[model samples]
Target: MTDLSKRRLKTWIRLLGVTRGAENHLRDYLRRAHGTTLPRFDVMAALWRRRDGVTMSELSRLLLVSNGNATAVVDRLEADGLVRREAEDGDRRRIRVRLTPEGLEAFEIMALGHEAEVDAILSRLSETDLEALRDILSRAGRPE
Candidate 1:
């Protein structure tokens, strides 16, 4: 039992370190290559997925962030003409936000770069290694 616990502890630490390292690298890559922050990129990605738009609260929930954090990023995007907010028909207080055409174009470009950056970071891993890691993660929990 102690041996199993030790092994699991080591595995968890290694997994966490690698995840954090990759995330940090992507964050820096986005900032330097696209002049965008990770939070902004995340918000744009979520909006891109939901073309019809989502309420501000929904966006916050999707991003797993506080409303203030989500709103601040949205505020900046709106000022840049990258996003537009519209009030719901029946409930004026429920503002739905979506990417403008320009925002879509911008996010598409950034997403391509983001993919490339991730690929580069993980290039050392063989296809078999990646597949095995994916399987393990899938078994562990969420599928994201």
Candidate 2:
């Protein structure tokens, strides 16, 4: 492999390792601190970030999960009173999901704990490094 190929491969390896570690840390923290699983927290976090309700398709895309999986997760959230589903008056087939007030409160609590955990994990990195990491990952959202 060329030097550039080797560098890219090494970067991938580092990224995968770091991602797995971070995922585990977050999962363990959420479970112990909030009694929630990572997937449940992810769905709530996505909705918490959006003040306006999102469609099922949009949530599925944002979460990178299948539509059926999104539907099932949303169902559980709704049953827990953390989320509500509303049908569009003009389009009965369209459903929108929004976080309930209680959901917002719960998310805020979880988010505070999550941020603290992130800070502890990322304490070795300077603010500039964090910004660079954010910029690099933001590129993943770009279309091909």
By lDDT, the best candidate is: 1
Off by over 4 Å in 2: 132-144
Candidate 2 RMSD to the real structure = 2.5
Q: What is the C-alpha local distance difference test score of each model?
A: 0.94, 0.90
What are the per-residue Cα lDDT tens digits for candidate 2 across 1-144? Answer: 999879978998988999899999999999999988888888998998887889999999999999999999889989999999888676879988989999999989999999999989899999899899889998854657
Top of the candidates by TM-score: 1
Model 1, span 26-136: residue lDDT tens: 999999998999999999999999999999999999999999999999999999999999988878889999999999999999999999998998999899999998898
Ten contiguous residues minimizing lDDT sum, candidate 2: 135-144
State residue 6's C-alpha deviation in candidate 2, in Å: 1.9
Q: lDDT, candidate 2, residue 57? A: 96
Error of 1 at 124 (Å): 2.0
Clash count for each candidate, listed in order shown: 0, 0
Displacement of the residue 38 alpha carbon in candidate 2, Å: 1.5
